[model samples]
Target chain A: MAPQGPRRGPVRDGAGRAGRPRPGSRRCAVTQRLAPRWLEAETFDCRDAFVETLVALASEDPRIVGVVNDSVGSSKLDAFRTAFPDRLVNVGIAEQDMVGMAAGLAGGGRIPFVSGAACFLTARAMEQIKVDAAYSRNNLKLCGMSPGVAYGELGPTHHSIEDVAWLRALDQLVVVVPADPVETAAAIRWAAAYEGPVFVRVSRTPVPQVHPADHTFTPGRATVLHEGDDVTLVSNGTVLWRALAAAEQLAAEGIGARVLSMASVSPLDTAAVVQAARETGALVTAEESVPRGGLGGAVAEAVVAHHPVPVRMLGVDAFAPTGSAGYLLDRYGMSPEGIARAARELLHRRRS
Target chain B: MPSTLSHAHLTLTRAPRPPAGAPRDEVVAQLRETARQIRLQDLALVHFAGAGHIGGDFSAVDVLTVLYGAVLDVAPDRVDDPERDRFVLSKGHVAGSYYVTLAAYGFLPVEQLATFLKPLSTLGGHPNRLHVPGVEASTGPLGHGLPIAVGQALAARLDSSPRQTYVLTGDGEMQEGSNWEAMMSASHYGLDNLTVVVDRNGLQQGASTEASMDLAPLADKARAFGFAVSEVDGHDHGALLDLLGSRERPGGRPRFVIAHTHKGHPISFMSDQVAWHHKVPDADQYATARAELDALAPAAGGAL
Candidate 1:
């Protein structure tokens, strides 16, 4: 349900604008680029990088197998099925059975990557994911493809906005949301090598490359995309680049905003969040999810527990009207300029 | 674990096993005696713990004894072997029976039955594979174990291992949609190394299964779902040994065995009784059931 008050704060027309260069910001000094590399023209789907990395990892490890609930095409696993036909166990359209079978396969010493639509895979068989995989400590990988509101106009039933909240609550499950193609590939590879249950959100919406090609993912580590001291913008998933853009815009206006890409949601990088809270004294969280229980909720929890700050959260707070993914995101105040506006408001609140 | 043996440990020890290469009749006799002793121990567990699914436990005892005694190739030492046969108790409300059965097979220490259902005990109301040594999966909820078993079967096939996978479900539990989903994939993959046994005890928690949801013609339903279906007397140790131990997978499909059993089987007052599904017997009822089991044979208390 959407709140009745001015929960969205103020609207700024320039917020939806894609990219604005910050040549005078600390990002330019750190990465040796005039603007953040994520502002480039080309955008890439994280699913492509997911499948490519999976195939490369599967070639070296025979224990790696793909389990799908009839999502070979939707999960972009056609090449994986072709290459490893027998290894790909397609339990057609049964999410419960698919997750249980993945645990069973892991019990028999085969690593199973269960891929399906983020909505059905997380909600439909949540009990199986909890008891069989997380509670039992089964070495399984659950790839939630097209996570968050990436389904766009397909309706909220198909949107997995609550997946991070649901999965991170499980005891032994590792929840991860990769920001871009390079990070997605690295997270998949890292999950494959880790000896435990992992739920990695693979986004279908296109995003520009955020990390360098040589980036290696470490669990529970947050990347500081832009160095600033006025306010911290903690974001992940498809909304990460937008947060970076918001920081660039804030930098152009002489208000430094620190951008932290918090990909690991469960074993959250609380140290980085605490550092940001103590240094900046104000924080704003943005995600491609509900405003209350996803990334925004996580950062708020970490901040209040370790170092309290004036935290502002931005996300899809209600069932969106019929619109494209970009439109819905902008309407929900997750656009770059909208995030900058929220940060400015939070900064003003702290000043007063 | 607690060391003091409660009354639940009355005459608890390893169940008698048939000698290696024993004749069919001898094996059947030993299995029957073991089942009777396991029933006695299971009864004590419920009576002492003051709670259990005693009805389902009694109905599943004969089948469980037959598996551990003669059918399965599992051993306490080889619990972690990847190629070992896998057994999952899908009807996990009967953890009392499962725990005693594991104890009787030396998979767990016999004295540990004292801690069953106790506070901070490893043996909770349901089987947790993490806590128990021989348990393959921690299953409590209905319709969960079969899918896990099916996946295990698929993994064995992928590895080209001859290890067989088995799961036991309560007849009432068949109404859950997940079991049907698993059956579809098990049949679709032609998983010949899998066996699914249903404790067709005709009773759910509150009513007869037929009145709750008719599973009449269950064999036909399983057949439609791609299993080679058969029916047997669940308590008949001889028959259970033959059908479940049969390596033959006709048509190269998964096997579904419907063991026609009565809830709270063999005990006159409890047999086929709906109220006894999870009822804890009082002192008088407990004494009567214990006497009924002990009189079955002279060596009914963990002796052959």
Candidate 2:
């Protein structure tokens, strides 16, 4: 149903590779060292960080409980179930029931963190999430694990590309996608403490450490990792590091680029987006999601409303063909070179 | 809120309780009268509002009255008590019935009945926990309530509170796959404190349940799903209270009560009639149904 949305301006295939820069593209200052060529060898799974932070928080607060749809192993809740055996409620493959149960549990004065695969949790039980959690304003945390095509070999059915767009459209739900382990841990802590419905996308695909150990996540706030003026590169979740690499490539070519990590997608960091649009003049958005209603859509809305600017959105725009997660991202124009090329294109559009 | 109550209705609800240690027969008689009154008020709500699921409302009334009147350990005053028994109306389209029951019991003001289905009324086609005070969960979509009830029952157990959890679902609503899922968990957890009541009316909208989707042998299905199951006459106040309030609930098992009922029950010409599923009665039909309910009213001196 989504593939048929009327495209704006031209009928370009959503995933068509119209602009690709060769490897010999102009050398930027930090391209080789930071553009994933020297990609850090260390990788930490955010799901583990999620469990660690949840266990610590649950220990401090008795109201915290874990709810799952037979995802104890997949959602990394085995340790949680062991730590607080009775507190973990596994409903066994019923996503709708799992969400509704969480709503009822929250209504009963217990803080429930509902965890499951992002694909099923968002699509299979969307109505429950909309009415029971968001409309009712229940104190619940929806931990969407292994989000954004983390299950690469399993194909499109397992991909959570539509989660941000689907959930962001529903009011009262705060959509969050942590860029790395540190942000993932911080985001988990924040959602557990907040007193309303929240969807925290906790990834399974490992990424290098990005934020500080002490970094505290605040909702609706974006972190500016690198400051520049020529163009703003907005990204989050599994693709943020690749965007960081894209910025390094831009820097090596003497193209100053601002990088904004937009973890909060629903109640987005509008002020930051507007500032980037006005100060930087052009932008490119890289996300591990569809080009619609995600980081790209949110930034475009904010920019058009406050300050109009040429925006190039680089993300998965169609059903991914069979490939590993990294291969799929590169094929969908989410690679460092791809993002850098999109940034250059956005600058050229601004010049025109 | 319903603001159209006559003076007799206002005076009748002045006493919130009968004397403590009241005779069982006397309490059951009072409950029957209250259930009759719930039917009458819901009928009026449908007539005045020009819309409601009256068939389901009438079928579930006796069971609901028995719970709010005799079984549930709750008060309008203690609605927020963490230890209080939780009652969720899973068949929520019949909210008019539940609202008046709450009003009759003083959980909601009686005058609020006039506001039902009005523009921007708190009472819509379905219950909303946010807008309504006593509704535990807002349910319209079938199969949502039992799972939530399972969660509530689980929560009570975690607190080690003796607070019981009760949820009422329509017979036809059992077709939703979610109820069976909840049934599995209710038994898996050995939730002895939870009781699920199915208003086994023979009809849903547009057709008999048997014709729509046969859900017969429901008791055995529930048993297989891990619940100790029983069937009762839904309109029999004494039978409903006895089965629902029984303290002999076995260990490590949830209780399922199948209250056999007829859609638009007891109202001659409407009983078991499929058209009344959500039909708003005209002047003549309302008068006939209202007269039947008035005749069933407890003799003024019999009980409270």
Candidate 3:
């Protein structure tokens, strides 16, 4: 099946979380009236896009299979289980088994997408993912559901802020953080066709569409969302839209902030990051994860290695307090105003 | 499974053929000789390399000999056969015996055993499927192979293929909860094509399995997990062949054979000794061990 275009629809509760506010029905207080056009557009749960694309791909390819650790309702694989009952193997609540089994499935000439909550999936089965999938070069695709603090108020135990830092260290695994529903579908389709190890961080956080209707995912490539010359705001996943909104805010304040949606974290788009640093002179990175060893660390590693430029990273620093996902993101200086402030600080530090 | 045959690109120069259609007594005799040859080669490799789990290697060689020598439908020339029977050595510390067994079966050159743990050698402390053909999974960490074998069995069932998937895990490795999780999955799916053979040597690194984690009711545990459990003398080639070859999976459940074995089998000093788990034998010990292994088949030493 050819990849399908973006579907603009209501948040279908792919995560089965009740009482989630509809996109555009409620807006963050910091950017309430100043929300950009993209922020006001209809939003979607990327998990829905993930499953939709996975089902479509499975329909065409008999080799594609789904392996989960009893995360059917949470990972939104109920439809996939219904469609291909035998293809979906649920190793009940066993993350290590789930990943190892996926590697085995790949060894048996099946493309297995192992899905689970990012917290247990990465931390629990990390050795399996490292040995079976990465070092062994098994063609396994790992889908980390509800990554990067998407499970808010559930405490730090459930937060997946350390996933990127943990997974990007593996050599052969391609870690991708798709920005929106369209990009999520595109990444799934790409992973299905690609014949190697891949780890795609799929978020359940409802966010407005950031990519276009025909967005295509390329591994290790960045999509330049906004053009500027003064500074660059590099981000992806749920934080990319906020970075875009921050760029718009910076533009209003006579600051040219280029926004680069860096979805691939492992095989990072170092070329784009180097170009952004060379052209803009200063860069600010925002993510829904920790700045250290996450996107910020990756960007800083690239910039310091390739281009010598001052970079300000925006992300959660400490274990979060009690709050919702949006509140945690804002409290950690990830809001549009906060991101713009980070860029301004970079500029000021450079001037001083 | 794709018919395009995507395998690790290797220039394997396999030795010529011998058919396995011999009678029962002759087949068992051949398996014993094969085990003896592998043990002798593995003993020398471990002694020369100065590092290897000789205990576990010796414990697993008979089972490995039975599988590759007589049971499994894998061939050195057809390593990429999708319908071929799959075998995963989960207790990967004994890669010495594994590599020797593969070489004995002509998967690779028998002379390559000299490069067991040399610098830049493909033969690492653990078996890697990328560099070695006929290795189904690259396993070193405990509790990994069962789940992978479960996945392979699940894939076979999904394809509606008649291929069998087998995994050999250490009795001590049964302490890993992941093994139990995989057993649950295997039994839940009723994967009759999957067979799990536990190397029930009753020993681990620093202590016995019972003293470490107590898997005493191991067969009962597997039975409760919905497996058709069977206990066999691991070194008895005739019993291992009968149990592993044509055993029935009662009620279409998965097979879990508990192969009772000693830490170092048929070796006087090292047998059932915990200190020999990974201990490199000194010159005196090596001579004695080599001489003892040599007596198993006096004329077979020149085969490799």
Pick the TM-score winner: 3
Q: Write model 1 residue lDDT over A1-352, tens digit each, in one string.
A: 1101111211111212223333343222122222534334456667888888898899999999999998998988988988888889999999999999898899899999999999999999999999999999999999999887787778788888888888888999999999888899989999999999999999877676777888778888999999999999999988888888889989999999999998998899999999999999999999988867788888999999999888999988788777556667777887787888899999888788
The order of the candidates by lDDT, greatest first, is 1, 3, 2
Best by DockQ: 1
Superposed Cα deviation of residue A154, candidate 1 (Å): 1.2
Please give the clash total of every predicted structure, in order.
1, 11, 0
Provide per-model DockQ scores. 0.81, 0.67, 0.72
> What's each prediction's TM-score?
0.92, 0.91, 0.93
Candidate 1's error at A130, in angstroms? Answer: 1.1
Q: Which has the better DockQ: candidate 1, or candidate 3?
A: 1
Give the CA lDDT, 0 to 100, for residue B213 in model 2. Answer: 97
TM-score of chain B of each: 0.95, 0.93, 0.92
lDDT of 3 at A48: 87
| A84-187: candidate 3 lDDT, tens digit per residue | 98789888999988998898899889999999999999999999999999999999999999988888888789988998988999999999999888899989
Model 3 misplaced regions, further than 4 Å: A1-28, A36-39, B1-20, B298-304
Q: Considering summed lDDT, which 10 consecutive residues are worst modelled in model 3 chain A?
A: A9-18
Off by over 4 Å in 1: A1-39, B1-8, B299-304
